[model samples]
Target: MTQATPQAPAFQLHDEPGHLIRRAQQIAVSKFHEVHGRHVTPIQYAILRTLYESPGVDQVTLAQLIALDTSSTADIATRLEAKGWILREVLPRRQRRLSLTPAGEAILQGMRSGIEQMYLGMMDSLDGTEQREFMRLLRKFVHLNDQQNKPVDTPTKG
Candidate 1:
């Protein structure tokens, strides 16, 4: 005789917004990897994309721009540097600035189509209106919860 599956808790994971958001993130990451992992990780792509628009930004600024912690940002930068996609230099006041090398720009150019497809695929489940509304609501959610959702840049001085 086949055994029946055990019942889950009344509060199912699928009904949770946080769980759903995380699942959505996983899906996006999978698509991102499928299209671009051979060339660069998602965070690296964010860094490159930001640098393309705002070159010569400092590490701290770049970290905030991508909503990543400074340490993780630095680590990713190290890997990107090794890949010859970025250059980091220390300036006065111990600030480190990041710039995209020509290689970085070219690689980003190559990945543009894949990136577009990844975005499209991720939102393909929604109709055009739903997609726009979904994005708007997500942005609003972030704005409303930014203080809690966003990582603190630095400790407040006493």
Candidate 2:
């Protein structure tokens, strides 16, 4: 005889968002690991993509764009530099910039197709319009979250 499945609690957005986010993150990370055949963190992918898209972006800009602290970005950059995937050049006259070596470029290009395919396959349920709407709402959510994390200064009445 088959065992009965347990029932879940009623749907509640506040109660479910965190669980949903964690599950999605786990699934995405698993899929990425399967595709890459190694343990590549999500931040590394972000750094690689950012460098690939905008060559010669300085570490400061990279940190800001990626929403990482300076020290963490520095550590990541150092590791990537050591791996020979990236190079950091010091410019005495100008801001030091980071650029991906040919190896980095090739790796990113190689992974680009797979990444695109992964996203397309995952979002296959959503049509073009739905996908666009989803992206829009996601961006809105991110912006709101950023705002929420900012310090709020209350007005003082004299």
Candidate 3:
């Protein structure tokens, strides 16, 4: 019989990307539910808030703004439209744009306080300096990671 190969040891705490991401998502989801109740998800609220801030934004732009794939954005938009939370309108010679309906606005208004509280709670453990540094590092990491996906020869100037 052949000898068996040795198995590799598992990664340490800092090296576990999947575990870290999952744990972070779990904590964030629980905190979000605590703030917004069980009805709304963080993603749904995020899309709604984006629409609220920039009314009539195009779906393509929205997808880019939220860092989601085109298909995922389309799915979310379709669901929100069905729920009467948003209106998707197509203008002549232009792309489809998204706008918040009155009901959507009303729901968002009700969620504003809780959302703010959720933000506060998420960072409750961090002092001002730590919060700022954490935000800075997270942004830097996302920016660099996104850069890796950029197409070569894309114009630098608008």
Best model per TM-score: 1
Residue-level lDDT of model 1, residues 1-158, one tens digit each, is 99999987789889988999899888888899987875678888899999999999999999989989999999999899999999999989988999999999999999999988998988889999999999999999888877646777998899
For residues 1-158, what per-residue lDDT tens digits would candidate 2 score against the true structure?
99989987798764797888788788888778777767456788889999988899998889888889878998998988888889999877655699999987877888888798778877788999999998898788777887446889999999
> How does model 3 score by TM-score?
0.82
What C-alpha lDDT values do all the predictions have?
Answer: 0.91, 0.84, 0.87
Clashing pairs in 3: none
Regions of model 3 farther than 4 Å from truth: 1-15, 92-94, 147-149, 152-158
Could you tell me which 10 consecutive residues in candidate 2 have the lowest summed lDDT? 33-42
Candidate 3, run of 10 with poorest lDDT: 147-156
Query: How far off is residue 114 in model 3, in Å?
Result: 1.0
Candidate 1, lDDT over the whole model: 0.91
Would you list the rank order by TM-score, best first? Answer: 1, 3, 2
Better of 2 and 3 by TM-score: 3
Structural similarity to truth (TM-score) of each candidate: 0.85, 0.77, 0.82
Q: Which stretches of candidate 1 lie over 4 Å from their true place?
A: 1-10, 148-158
- Deviation of model 2 at 153, angstroms: 4.8
